[model samples]
Every structure is written in C-alpha cells, then in structure tokens.
Target: MSSAMFARDVPFERSPTTDLPVLLPPRPRERFGWPKLTTRHALLFAALVLVAAGAAFAQAPDAPPAPASEALTTAPATPLSVVVKWAPLLLKGFIFNIVISVAAMTLGTITGLMLGLGQISQNTIVRRLSWFFTQFFRNSPWLVLLFFAMFMIPFQVRIFGTTIPLPDWMKAIVGFALPVMANVSELLRGAIRSIPSGQWEAAESLAFSRTKTIWQIILPQCVKRMLPPWMNLYSLITMATVLASIVGVGEMLTLTAQVHAAEGGRPELFAPLYGFAGLCFFLYCYPISKLTQRLERRYNVKT
Candidate 1:
C-alpha cells in the first residue's frame, strides 16, 4: 500500500494478519524525577531530615549551657523527647485550629455566594452595596480585622432575653470569615464573568430566565474553574489559623508556647518546637496545594 493510503484520520496501525486498523494506546503522561518518589514520600523524607537536624542541634556539645537557676531546678531532656511527651496536647490544640478553619470557610462560602450574586444584580443599590463590601473586606488587613473582632465584639449577647456567652475562638471565626467571605465573593464574580458572552446570548435565545440560566448553565461550568482557587483559598485559611495564637485561642502555636514556658523556657527547645508546629502546618497545607495544582491542570481550558 502507498503512504497516501496509510494517511488515515483515525489514530491506528494496520495489523499484518487481519489487515485491520488497531487502535493506538494512549500516550503515557510524563513524570518528573524518580518513578516511585511521590510528594508524600518526599515530604516524609524532609520531615525526617528536619527531625535529625534538630536532634543534632539539641545534643551538640558546643551548645550554650543553661542558666544556673534553670539547670538547678529542672533536669535536661532531649528536644525530641520533650516534643513526644507533649505531642498529645499539642495535637489537640491543632485539631481546634482545623475546626476553626472549617467553620470559618463554611460560613464565609455561604455568605460569599449570596454576596457574589448580588454584585451582578440588576438592582443598582444591591450591586453597589455588594461591590463596596467586597472591596472593603478584601482590602482590609486580616490581622486588623481579627483584632477588631476580638476587642469590639461583645463577649455575650442577649437574644429574646436569653443570655449567650461568646468565646474568643468564636469571635476569631467571625473575624476570619469576614475576609474569606469577601475574597470568595470576588472569586465568584470573576469566575462568572470569565464565561463567554456567547453563553449568555445562547441561554437567552432558549428563553431561559437569568436565574435559571445562571443556576443551570453558567454555574455548572464555573465549578471546575472555581474549584482549584477555592481549595487554594482554604489552604491559606488553614495556615492563617496560627494567627489565633496571638489572641489566646489555644491553637497549636499557643500551646507550643505554653510547652516552652513549662519546659523552663529553654532557649535550645525554641527552634525545634516551633519548627515542629510549622511542619504540622506544612504537612497539612502542602497536600492541599499539590491537589490544587493537579486539579488546575486537569480542568484547564485549552482556549
């Protein structure tokens, strides 16, 4: 057969015996580095290296000696030993941080969705108000907002003559949620606008109402576009949970501080303890970031 006869549209090769076109196998995806070295394995390896380094630093003979008072009162313990001893308590505090992040994200997403819809509303007042709020919270410093919530908001409220006390962490959630809501509002608005104008025209041509078109058509498409960024935002929120330590929320960092103080405020323990806290956050958020990258690639639009 001539080469012209083999120039077919389908991706296939001819089988010698049957003279039939055999379908080609899919191309293998390219992977960087070693085949068995996954992200999890790399992270675990890095953690081990960090632990080993910290141990070496702690036990180094050339390290500074403890103060006379501290040395006399408390027996010296290895950094790893101290960390292991308090791991349970530190972990409990870390769980609280996760809870705070989750609650804030949920509350923020709900409010943000409504606010986002408002930004594109036909009503002038609604659109302007939504825009204003979105800008206001989005631009404000997160730390300032957190501080405002802590001091300005009351510790309790009387509703229907029922006295309900508000805790510090609850206020912290509200503080964190405000910025999250604003950012999400902006995210939603941007995602909605990214859809081609032709889609709107097509939906209108079908006699689909604005609300129906948005809910049924535009939003479904936007979900994939929004997911990666939304997840990235959640990772940021999770890491920011450490800021709660400043306000005495008893998160991991705060507990770590308490542990340090309880352990005689040993200068040597400072780096390892804080480093461990950071590693916890890294392990948690790094996976989220990697997953976000994978999703972004998967859902990427060629156009």
Candidate 2:
C-alpha cells in the first residue's frame, strides 16, 4: 500500500461516520435526587429550625411571660454576670458536698471491709449475718434508708456523761454510708472469689489461719481487682450525695436551688445555674471515671 493508504489505516484515521462518540465514564451517575442525609445533617437541620423558631418566639410581642420555675427558661442578656455573682456561694456548697462524700466514703470503706470479711467466715452465723447486712442495705432504696436514719436514729446519746448531738448532716452521712458499705462488701466478696483456688490451697499448705490467709495473701492480690470498682462506687456515692438535699444537707444542688430562688426566680437563670451545677459535677465525676478506666486497664480487671 502507498504511504497515504498506510496513513488512512492508522487507528485515529477512521471515517467520521464510523467514529464512536468518546463517552467519558458517564460522569459518575451524578448522585441525583438529593444527597443522602446523615445523622449530622439531620441534627444540623433540626438545630437551625429550633433557632429560627426561638428567634420568632422572642420577637412575638403578645407572648405571655414564662413561669420561671416551670419551663426551660430563656437566658438573660447577662448570663456570665449571673454566674460570676452566684458562683462563690455555689462553690461553698460544693465544698460541703465534697466533705460529705469523702467522710462517708472513708467510713463506708472501713465498715465494708469488716462486712466483706464477715461474709466469707467459716461460721454459719457470721456468714448469714453478713449476708443479711448486705442484702438489707443493698435492696433498700437509698431514700428510705435516709428517712430511717433521719427518723429512727436518736438525735442525742449520753456517752461518757456528755450528751452528744447528731446533726442532720451527720445523720445524712450515716444514711449514705449504709448503702456504700453494702455495695463495697459485695465488691470485696467478688474480688476474693476471683482469686485462684490454688492460692487458697497454697496458703493452707503453709498452715496459715483463715484470717491470716485473707489478710496476708488473698487480699493483697485482690486489691488490684477491688480498686477499680471501689473508685467507681465512690464516684456513684458522690453523685448520690445530691440526694442528701432531701434531708436538708445543703449540698451543691440544694444551694443552687436556693440561689436560683434568691435571684428573683428569674426564668432566664434556670439553664445557666443548673447547667453550671451540672458542669461542676461533670468536672468532678469525669476525671474519676477516666481514672477508673485507667486502673481497670492497668490491673486487667474488667470490673
């Protein structure tokens, strides 16, 4: 064939009519209709709608004044100032709560340790009594126990010729401690049970007494297991201390409510005040939770 004929046979040299349209891979099908709405998108849309509705409500002249104590109130223009003004008083109450939590936890832990050891006693009476103690406190509602402690426990006792008076706060602590002690006893029981049976056998071969074996060998090993749960329980107890308000303990929530009332029962202050209280609690509890997790990981204990 001549050079011109060869040129015509080149792949690019087909007749225009014979040429196929160069179709670029259909432009990825243009994901038509609407974009798939994700949780994030839905939330954002909902938030925008809420904001618009709020703005519209705010602008409505004929809207009735909201009851301060009833609804989720609108914040005042100066929320920061309100927080700053009330924060000092709230801090003092929060400190009181801390004191109660710490005191209750300390007493509870000591009592719980004794009860836990009692649960595993060889004697039937001791074991049954310990079980009874645990069940009684564990099953009882905290509020009921609080009321019992408040009402049943005497206000005064003559000890060594001194009339010692039990105040409401002290009584509240005793009430809180009962539940804490019970739960801690369970924690101890579980931890002790978790130890390998061979360890008990080994202790026996060494001629260790039951008490000695527990105190010296078994308990030392169980400490790591018990620690995470103990800390977690303390955190729970700390949260529950808010219930002390029922007995007039004057903790953070109680004082916050008082402060809210004192601030003219302004509907707007509700969120900021309560939100601040919540933030305080979160600050306290979150670190504890994180610490518990870390201890759990470090000890390789799931509890």
Model 2 per-residue lDDT tens digits across residues 232-264: 988888888889898888888999889878877
What's each prediction's TM-score? 0.82, 0.75
Report the error of model 2 at residue 147, Å. Answer: 1.4
User: Candidate 1 lDDT, tens digit per residue, 117-184?
Assistant: 99999999999999999999999988988998999999999999999999999999999999999999
Count clashing residue pairs in model 2. 0
Assess each prediction's global lDDT (C-alpha) against the native: 0.87, 0.81
Model 2 bad stretches (over 4 Å): 1-77, 301-303
Winning candidate number (TM-score): 1
lDDT for position 85 in model 2:
91
Worst 10 residues of 1 by lDDT: 29-38
Candidate 2's TM-score reads 0.75
